[model samples]
Target: MKNILLIIIGTIMLLSCQRDDTEQIRIKTKELISTHFMGNGVQWSAYPHGDTENGEWGKLMTSEKWEMNFKRLDYMKPKLFRVLDQANWRYMVGFDSDGEPILDFHTPEVKAVEKILSYAQKNNITVLFGEWGTPYKMHDLDAGNSDKFKGANDPKWIRSIVAYLDYLIVKKGYTCIKYYNLVNEPNGDWASTKGDFEEWAEGVRMLTAALREKGLDKYISVAGPDAVTRYDNPNSTYSGAGWVRETAKQLDEMVGIYEVHDYTEYDLVRSGGFKKYHGDIAQLMAHTNKQIIFGELGFSRNGVENQERASRDLYACEDSQFDVFKFSYGVDMADAVIQSMNAGYSGAAAWALDDAMHTCGDLGNKNELKRWGMWNSLGTELCQNPADENMRPWFYSWSLLCRYFPSGCSVVKTDSTGIEGLRLTAGVYNDDITVAIVNNSGVDNTISLNIPTHKQLKKFLYFDGDRAVDVNRFPIPVEEKIDAKHSIELTMPASSFVILTSLDY
Candidate 1:
């Protein structure tokens, strides 16, 4: 009798230990919050989806290749495609010797712009048309200093730009352009001309009135003063340029969205910038009726060795170095998404979609300014496969957030204890709920999901060190069903991202 009792006790102790190894995560299903929509931004005028056709090794943009690339956009089903017309406005529109604007439909750049808009229209994506500048000679705008800037407040210059917008909507049949931004980054080099906030506001008001007078106001709206720096600090270009506060006061009714760009390091986000940045966003929102948005969010990896290489170049890089870069980049992308959603942003779009041609200047310039493209085109000689456009680890990283949460999802407050850097954003859409976990703590942790409403596990997606480089290379996560008590446990790998979708009751 004593021996039988001893055996029973031993078996019970072993089972309890096994169950205790798994971690527990408790979730509050009723506590919900707002989440911003996730979208994409692309500079398609310069980059052919897959058909650059340079004829060196793997550079060929065929119709099939274009379709394959668009399928990437389809995978995420992004809400917007902010199309940038590369500055060289002379090639897009012409000026008579008398200075009257003439629409040029024969330019390849114009045709490229048309093709991009057509794709966006077909895919149900919103289009935001933006230009860097017109011919400097036509506007007589100096490129060097703000004091010499005279283009924005100039009536003739404003009319010329408004006329081009008319050509796009009224003549060439690109009625899909719902938003127009007069300048790219008025506070930075991409600025069309140097001008203070009031001067730029005058240009914006002129353009707004012109659109309304032309009967296009019902179809299109203006979103502007797209500055790259924050508004809080006067030392920053945006604050110094005076667009942040001045636009709110002068052109509040003319502008519909407060747009800005962010390329700050992740370390700053941890140190205190997260709160400061979001606090500034709140201040802007309070000051205006319009919503706030991050038009561009990406870090440049320019000086990093092998930063421009394709996946084929993986062999040339040290395993440790490449792994760290991939992991860190993925984490940063995930963190950006979480931060934007937490701040209640209207919509957040990434910098770009692809590296146009291997030698396209946009590729090099974007690499220098913001290396945040989803696909990097390997130079003609180095592409190993016929379909090798060199999708970066970020491709899958961004997809993890966009695909799982979608645009119309509502975020809920999910408290995660025990780990320092593990952040979560839970989005609920209709009958589905998705919880995305970004683990940057460098230690494997267990996530205990306690949801009383969800009982069915819909799907699981992840990207990490073992499967960072290639989208097709990932292991299946261990399946877990909601326990009889209404809970589930997941093992989250260190320096990785995971998404869990469940059926909402």
Candidate 2:
């Protein structure tokens, strides 16, 4: 009996030691956050939905718009694809194209398509097909002249596009290529640009239904890409971006996500900025049950600096709160992650990968500006070149997020409105074995992550620049590595983004 007691004591001691070790390994690799949800331009119209554009003139970028980086193998990698051009749709119906069509996706452009596919496949990136065409041909529906369905897609065309999407998805092996935006800005009638709401809704519903019928509904999201309206200044180049939230209130079919464009421009104009954090975007996300994507946003890259927000309208969805530097049209990776995560979203795509700095401006020197490519247009520079990890501020911002968070991770929101520079998002990673704590704040915000106890942590990785720390600059600056637990506290910096690894199962 005495011997039995000794064995029991030994076993108990061993168990306690095991628990202690588990606690030790729960290392808190702090401030890991997603910089930019790696994204590039996509368009179904650019695709032809299986049909080919026989020689329609492409959207002719002025020589200025074609600002080449002048250093790459092809000046412009040209691996990007275009959706159906709104102009091309008009051509199909024998009507005038209000917008330029993205024609020229023929054999000559095969290389571009291949490059996009190859890059995406290798990097595990996501390329989404956004708004490029209406549901029906332009002349066929007379939407160009009608305010109701103006700038909206036509029903017939929308249905056909869905079928084509399946074929492309299956044929092209587009596994990483999902997340489609059915139309762009459907509040017609909201922006005063004009478009049918009920018709657009029908198109969204039909396409979603088609996906369900094809058993691909689970893989796609049928939604709108509407911009928020400005209640203060009703007339401006950015005036049409405004939309009615109720128009996008609900999609007819089950949705996987909801994408919102920056209602304001990339400029510092008080009227061109987005309403205060919670006014438009924040409130929109809260009201909707769909995944939100800031699919389009950018500054004019030419706005005057130093605007006074003291007298600006912070309510009515007016976007005059961000500082002028924030509105310079340059992509701020840290800010993007902070804003998106704080909004409790899956991810958000910026205006573009490269804002090819236009060398020439007016006089049709459109290249000097207007060209929003993040890199030199048509240049070999990375879409967003992060020399130190290619973690251009935007790219680095998304790094911490994607590396650790699952594709389906939901925003486990905390109760703070404008954490200012701080953005926090919590979710399960690696099949729930690891709990991801993303801090996109510029300052060190304390993240008290709540996870199941006894889950030993392995190591932590922080991404703040363009590339991973091992591969680039600006890694997580962890003052200390704590173990895994619900109350794990770690300092997250405004410039820092990080990830934590644990075996909490």
Candidate 3:
């Protein structure tokens, strides 16, 4: 009888300890980083090919296809519309050999610009008019003289650009234009020397003064240096953060916004030194008051993973397989955005909104060239014929950020442990809290977000090798409510993107 009672007591104690362990939960606290975000923006560069039938823009401007694209854009709710002033063929449409006043806006590109501006105005999106380079006339004495180009610092170039801006805003009545980027990637070829930066600054000052004289200054602000390469490289005199600092010191308030294009595939978060890069850039905030924006960002089409093989099974022309490589590309891009914002950037823009119908560059041309569009503008030659304007996996991947932490939401910091190969970004939409997790590891994960036990886990969406789908819509529930101990567990698939929200707003 004594032995029987001892055995029973031991078993009871074991059961009780097990119960206590189950009741214990992980607790996490998150705090806000910023009060507001400047909203998401996209470029309206040559979206549709210039060609008539298959091209996306000009010929199909009024067609059902174009309408569908805009409908999709409307869903994204883009805050800023960066417009390209230079079109495919020439510097501008109206330049003549006689050097007459060049205000003619009759070409397809000009018409496209007008249409885009009108659409943006209707949607209340700010327009950032950007010039890719000096006009052909300003650079070349004759139309075909590529070698006879004058440098960007020339006074004649400045005057001509200002004249063009005056024509676009004051003369043509594009009153909706809000921002102006003087030249895209000037450090690449246009302006290199510290003196050159000063010249560029002077040009901006003259241009703003001209616009103010025309009474359009109130409508348009200026952003500059549009450096294409890294702005923080120490070895190079004209590249990296050193270059940006020198340029900013020269420009001062001539330009209120400092911008750059990031085509960084080599330096990714996975490489382990990306945080230091952001930290270095953030250090620049101490010197200048200019708001920094990564205006254009994308990974190379011929990415480091692999690109030599041809994709056999998919739609359109044969190209690289849309599997892990594309998935990784999207994941890396998400990290760049997160890090950029975390480092105090105002906002970031994807390199492009849509991929082109045809391959662009000669040297880099392939059967299915990488034009860096969110959607693949596949031609009608492949298995899924007439896929001229179909969305790619990236469209879904990017929508994760667009859907959850929208513009005006405040960024927050979250603490966690035991989660590997995962990046979490949180934002507060008034009283509602949103947490986004991007999982790059090849294994599925069960995450326990430590928060208030009283709050209910409202909704969630996830994307893994697919478009973002609502978790609640699935047969199985993916999000669990916080238990009495204040722990909410979530199961995230490998290479997935998840967004979780609290029930109460």
Ten residues in a row with the worst lDDT in model 2?
68-77
- Between candidates 1 and 2, which one is better according to lDDT? 1
In model 3, which runs have C-alpha deviations exceeding 4 angstroms?
A: 1-32, 47-62, 87-91, 94-101, 137-149, 154-160, 163-176, 189-199, 229-237, 301-325, 357-370, 381-385, 416-420, 450-460, 465-486, 502-505
- The total of clashing pairs for model 2 equals 78
True lDDT of residue 312, candidate 2 = 39
Candidate 2 lDDT, 181-251, residue by residue in tens: 55555443333223544555556676776777887765666545444333223332223232335434555
Q: What TM-score does model 3 achieve against the real structure? A: 0.75
Candidate 1 lDDT over residue span 378-412, tens digit each: 32323344344556666666665655665556667
Output the better candidate (2/3) by TM-score.
3
User: Candidates sorted by TM-score, descending order?
Assistant: 1, 3, 2
Task: Report, for all candidates in order, the number of backbone clashes.
Answer: 5, 78, 9
Best by lDDT: 1
lDDT per model, in order? 0.58, 0.40, 0.56
**Residue-level error in angstroms, candidate 3, position 394:** 1.3
TM-score of each prediction:
0.76, 0.54, 0.75
